[model samples]
Target chain A: MRRAVSALLALLIFAYLFGVLLKAPIPGDYRDERYNYYSPLSGREANESVPDHYVERGEEETGSQNIVTSIVVLYRGFDTLGEVTVLFTAATGVAFLLSTQRSKGEKEKKKEPNFMASTGVGLVLPFILLVGAYIFVHGHLTPGGGFPGGAVIATGFVLMLVAYPRFQLREKKVSVVEAFSGLAFAVIGLISLIMGLTFLENYLPKGVAGTLLSAGIIPLIYIAIGFKVGSELSAIVSHMKGGEE
Target chain B: MMANLPFIMVALFIAIGLYAVLFKTNLIKIVMGISIIESAVNLFLIAGGYVKGGIAPIYTSAPEGEEMVLPTPQALTLTAIVIGLATTALLLSFVVLIYRHYGSIDSRKIRGLRE
Candidate 1:
């Protein structure tokens, strides 16, 4: 009865908020030129809608066929850097927490690995890694990007953990990859600064948009993000597994 | 009214998540509530970026005249999702530590947190 009453109260609150939201003056359509023309970055006006601006000129500006990639890795690169740092910090925190020593008698009991599970994971592991690599590599031209690709790679690590309980990821190698990729991301931004552009400015040449090798620095940043996020998440999983002291 | 259906759904999700967070005693349920809230906010963001008849913001072979949904919100949502993942991991780690120290995950019984 108490649960029901609380739920009803929540529903009432939500209904009120929803009514307020509905009454809020959101534009019915966002196709207006005036709404799109304003650019805070350049303090200049464009005739096209905001998304249209990115869609129309983003390819030329960033040399990436995938406009979303251009937006994420090129335009808002600083925010992405902060996001990567947050993930890295969280992974490090988890590692620190799980590094606490366990009493010898309280050690987890080992379960026998199933033959079918191990064999199946072994069969699919290589393919999963391949797909992850493909996703990050083609991020500049495809729907996938560094974050999703890194998650896919971490999923492979998860599979290994599930199949072989004793399997441990080498912390040293993972940390090295994570550190270098993070440093490389920052270094690229520093290099752009050296070129007299603002931080994370695309100083590299904008090659052809549609080709695999195009999108000059966009792909490089995505590659760094991919490795960093993948290793960080994999390390998180390993920490959670608590196999290594 | 029909156009606001997605927003209504998002509100309902937020409401449910709030209920879970407010009334549930289990620490894990509170974490789950937090996740639900995060997802609801993400849905709200994506819905806010919707256009009347817009396609995706992708540029490869996009139709000549169709408007595209806002890409900025999608990017923001992606960032939020990543941050949410990190926070969730940290929260769960804290929960593990709590369970280890308190010997239970019940909110009422965890006296150390109440001082």
Candidate 2:
């Protein structure tokens, strides 16, 4: 009965979504006339062309050739900072929830996981860590970013705990990494302020746009983000896996 | 037909994932459904940034100019992937905790945590 109800609900939801999809205007075919009824300024030509100067300067000022990176790190640095903080808060919350000492009965009594799983995870661990670090490091230059890279690196800790149930992470050591990375992140932002720019502003030279070392604080900030994310994730994993057997 | 293949597949995968999430009774399966959705979205995001046969967004030489694939979507997808991992891990941990408490991995039995 529950399955039937759920299936019916799912069907209804999909049908509604399909209806909305059919009614929605396609991106390329977007027209002012379609949205005319919703406009506050009733008869105003309704379609206003945006200025190209900001767009053009954004292409040049941010240093990174990729327009998205330019906008993310330079044009909208504060939003990115907030996003990082959200991740940090989530990690903290997970750690807080999972942080608990093992009871007397559960202490030091570790059950061995399957040998195949252990060996498989062990073999894959380095590659995972490598990819994570690679993603973090190349964030500014490529498609990857600090958050993803950091999470990737932290998976190493999680995998270790899974493969070797006996492995316990010391919260103290992980906390140090977390704290230092966060501090470094704040310091980078402060440096921008000290240089007489707004908070998290790109005070350093916007190097020749498409090169590896081109975006000054862009790379630096991503590195800091990577460190922060890695440590935070590892800490969360440790907290979750550290307790009990 | 070939150009639209990836998008179609991704959309289908996402639909399947959404279907599984709503209908699956097992906690683990629901989590897998969520992961599948994440994967599908990642594929879509990556596909959105694709410039037909373009090189990596980096440039060893400047003369090649600026007609490259948008790196933003890829970066966004990468971030999304990380966030997805964190979410999935947290969800799995919750599932484990829920199982430990209820002695069952069934979602219907775990409704006690809802209120």
Candidate 3:
């Protein structure tokens, strides 16, 4: 049977992975304070890995207190931009696919949600939005960032959609939010380029490291990302739900 | 074997997902399997970057003399998670369309009718 063959194949793959990955060295054994990285450029054993440098010096170099934030928004910002583009493409595809199925969406007799659940969504949405905003705003100093913050805000919208089957997200407003936030990210990058720096390079002064105002363009980029992601996700949800525009 | 517990779990998760993808008949289940595979990959990346007793890579009010975990992997994982979300959404939309046209989500039925 196909199922039997696939199970055997999966088992074989698991065995191969177990053999290879289990033999690899354990990370962070605490026996070594210093990291050992083999650098191909110099063909030498270096005492510090790339991560070690990021941890030790990232704050001073990027003016961001969070090393992860520095890596995501500064060092690998081009990748983040690509990821956002991917999200946007997916959102557009979903909308395009579902937009043609208008007749079915209107015919289903949707049951009205109960009072408690509907009322609770109205009460809880603001706190969710506030937490999402806080997460992206303090991304340079906290564990949360643009993606999670945006997801949280989208969660609020999802809650609303689930509670009220008839609840509609204005498609125009959603697209405008998506467009402007996306433009904000690109505009910041263009500003950096016009200022005689590389694309997306920080143009503003790196303030004191621990403060909310620090990290130069890092927080700004994250804030932009938060808005962009939030709107795109909510738009996708609205499209999928077949809510009236 | 025990020292590699996290890696083993990651591999097992991936294997289970692979099995689902290969063996399942339902389109929706296949999408779930793909999402599971993404989660496993994210787990693998995080496990690879583990530093024992390491705190997050943030420097704001960080404890004195504590080691920080690798930042690059976590950043990469964040990217992966978002991409996974997008892919999952896209996949689900496709599944919905399939169901809409065919009135069923079973692969066997859909495959036979494909011209």
Candidate 4:
């Protein structure tokens, strides 16, 4: 009966998707001469007299070779904060779900797990850690960004836990990393206020574009995101395998 | 034909995943189905960002003002993959906990918890 119900639901979903595929409309932003293009209403342009140099300076103003990073970090920074909060909420939900059913006595057993799987994890974890960190640091200039890089880094712990069933992730390290990274993320945002901009606005010098050290708060935000995601995920994994407690 | 291959592949993967999630009796299989669905979504996203002849998106020693593959979707895919991994791990953990409590991994057998 459960299988049948699931099948019916699946069929419904297929029908919906099929219908959408058949009838999906072209997006309004398509550049076609025939279509009536909605133009943006003229708004108060920033006074050109104050500092015209900032407008002409494209990549140099952000240090990131990728314009997408600038749009995300500098232009739409407030959205990033909301994104972080969504992650935090998901973590909190996982914790709440897992903690409720944990048995009382399971908490007392803190013995270190056998090192059978630890040997293999110990061998490969450093490389994974290194790559994850590299991805986070070079996020602005490279293909990989903060969230993904952090996830890759977090997978190191996942690999360790899976390879060594007896080994548990050190809670102290996880907690410290999470706390500090989250703090740094907030601090970076707050500092934007100090720099005469709104929260998370770019406050640092927009060095030359395509340079390693460009994109004022972009790299910093990526690092913080990497750390935050890595610790949160590892903790989640541990909670999963933590079992009974 | 080749250009649309990725989209077709992603669609099929997602379809199979949805089937598995809906029809499989085991909770673990259902979770696997979800993961497969995530994989399909990620694949589609990455494919959407594909250029006819694009490099790995590194901006070094390239032609001036060259058109590059969209980076936004790649970034979005990374985020999706992370979210999928976290959710999958959590779901699997729940399955494990349920198995411990009921000694059965079958979803129907564990319906006792509902009442």
Candidate 5:
């Protein structure tokens, strides 16, 4: 009976979606200038939208090679801050809840990881960490940024945890890294204010666009975010494995 | 033909995910459904910014004359993806807590806190 209700609800949702899809045809490729944004800030008809402006003059204005990085790190920075906060909240909740609900006093005997799995992780772990570091460090000049890089780092740790359940990643140390990275992100944002610019505004010199060291505050912010996200995710994973209170 | 595939995939993904979420009795299956829904949304956002032959919005030795996909949706999707990650973590944690307390994960069995 409940399954019937669920199926009915799902069918209704599908019908509604089908109706919406029929009304609004999805374009495969948007190459038409007519599709260019109608600028609202300028109150002009079909004037350059924020994205068009960013595309045309992104390098000149932001000195960042990756346009997405410019938008994510500089223009919409405060929103990213909020995102970090949300992730932090989830990590904390996981840690707190799991710590409280310890799996009784006696720790279960852990099975040893197979030789192949442990050996494979040992060989691949360094490469994963290296690639993750490269991603965040080269965020401004590359496709990936903090989030993907951080995820990759966390993936390596996750692999370790899976291959060796007894392998302990000190929760205290992980939390320290998380706290420091979060603090570093805020500090980078505040430095812009200290320079008399708006919050998270680029204060440092934007060197040559496409260079590894360019994009000023953008790289710094991504680096902080990468570290914070990496540590937070690892801690959450550890907690899920029944970490101690 | 291929251009519209993304949206079609989006519809199918959402439909399946919705069904899983609405019909699944197991908490873990429900969480997986939620994740599927999130992926569908991400795909929708990305598809919203499709260009015929546009490249990524990066300038590092980019092709001399090529279109760049809209940066806005990608930016928004990035945030949405991370937020989804956080929410999923919380949801899974709740599932863990629920199992710990109730000794079961079937939603139908979990009626009240009166134990």
Candidate 6:
């Protein structure tokens, strides 16, 4: 009976969604003119085209060839910082919740992974790390950024953990890296604030947009985010794995 | 109407996820439901940012006069995806703890909170 009720409810929800989808404007067909100008202050329709304005002058203003990076790290930086905090909180909560269980030393014996799996992971680990580093380092000139790059790096750690069951990540080292990177992110913001700009304002030189070392504070911020995210995610993975004894 | 196929798919995803959350008795299935809902929301956001014949927002290679897809939504989606990862991890850890305590992941059977 419960299953029947659930199915009925799902069908009803699906129908409602279908109706809304049918009536909703098609994607890419609607273009709001308000997105074509730059308006820092309120009360101007002609000057409020945000996406268009950013596209036209983003590289010049932020020295980041990648407009998305400009948006993520510069214009909306506070939100990113908050997002990072959310990730950190989640990682900490997971560790705290699982730490009640006995440590790995007292856990049951783990089975040895297959030789083939171990060998493959060993071979691919370095490449994964390198690719992740490349993604964040070139964030200002490419599609990838701190979040995806950090995820890739954490995947490498997971691979190692899976292939070598006895292998352990140094918790203290990971924590240190996580803490320092997070601190650096905030410190860079503070530096900008001290320079008489708003928090996280770009005070450094806006170098050549397409160059590797360009986008002054952007690359620095992204690199910091990459390290912070990578370590926190790796810690989360290790904690969850430890719980699976 | 046909161009809205992706939106329809998004709706279906949310519905399926909602069904799983409401109807499933298994804790793990509920987690899966939540994940499906996350993906659906992400897809909706990405689709909302699409532009007809729009290129990517990168400055190096985009042709002159070509409209670029809105970058804000993509950035927001990236943040959401990362948050989703964190939330999923935390949820799974809770599931593990629950299973350890109750010896099973059946939602109906574990009524300690209610009692």
Candidate with top TM-score is 3
lDDT of 2 by residue, A1-245 (tens): 76677667656655664555445443223322333233355444433222122233445666765555655666667767766777777776676555542334434557888799799998999999899987866665666667778878888888888788778777777778778877887888888888888888787787776666777788888788888888888877776665533
Model 6 residue-pair collision total: 3
Q: Looking at candidate 3, what is the lDDT of residue B107?
A: 93
Fnat scores for every prediction: 0.56, 0.13, 0.87, 0.17, 0.71, 0.86
Candidate 6 Cα errors over 4 Å, as ranges: A32-47, A103-106, A243-245, B113-115
Complex DockQ per candidate: 0.60, 0.21, 0.78, 0.26, 0.68, 0.79
User: Local error of candidate 1 at A215, Å?
Assistant: 1.1
Residue range A45-71, candidate 3, lDDT tens digits: 765567877987788889998899999
What TM-scores does chain A show, candidate by candidate in order? 0.88, 0.77, 0.90, 0.76, 0.90, 0.90
What digit string (tens of lDDT, one per residue) describes model 2 on residues B88-115? 7678777766765677899778678552
Q: How do the predictions measure up, each by TM-score?
A: 0.92, 0.73, 0.93, 0.76, 0.93, 0.93
Compared with the true structure, what per-residue lDDT tens digits does model 5 show for residues B27-80? 999999999989999988988876767899998888999988888889999999
Clash count for candidate 2 is: 0
What is candidate 3's lDDT per residue for B7-72, written digit by digit as tens? 898889889999999999999999988998899999989988889899988888889999888889
* lDDT minimum window of 10 residues, candidate 2 chain A: A47-56
CAPRI grade, predicted model 4: acceptable
After superposing candidate 2, which stretches have Cα over 4 Å from the reference? A15-59, A65-68, A101-134, A162-165, A208-212, B1-11, B38-57, B60-66, B75-79, B111-115
Clashing pairs in 6: A35-A49, A36-A49, A37-A49
Question: Residue-wise lDDT of candidate 1 within A1-245, one digit each (tens)?
Answer: 76887788788879887997776445334445344456677687766556657876888888887778888998899999999999999998998887774434656877878899999999999999999999998988878889999999999999999998778899999999999999999999999899999999988777766888888788899999999999999999988888464
Residue A206, model 6: lDDT of 82
For each candidate in the order shown, give its overall lDDT on alpha carbons. 0.85, 0.68, 0.88, 0.69, 0.86, 0.89
iRMSD per prediction, in order: 2.2, 4.8, 1.5, 6.1, 1.8, 1.3
Candidate 3: TM-score, chain B only = 0.94
Model 6 DockQ, alpha carbons vs. true complex: 0.79
How far does residue A220 in candidate 6 sit from its true spot (Å)? Answer: 0.5
Report the TM-score of chain B alone for all candidates.
0.92, 0.85, 0.94, 0.89, 0.95, 0.92
Better-scoring candidate (DockQ), 5 or 6: 6
Question: Model 4 off-target regions past 4 Å?
Answer: A1-61, A103-120, A162-166, A243-245, B49-51, B54-57, B113-115
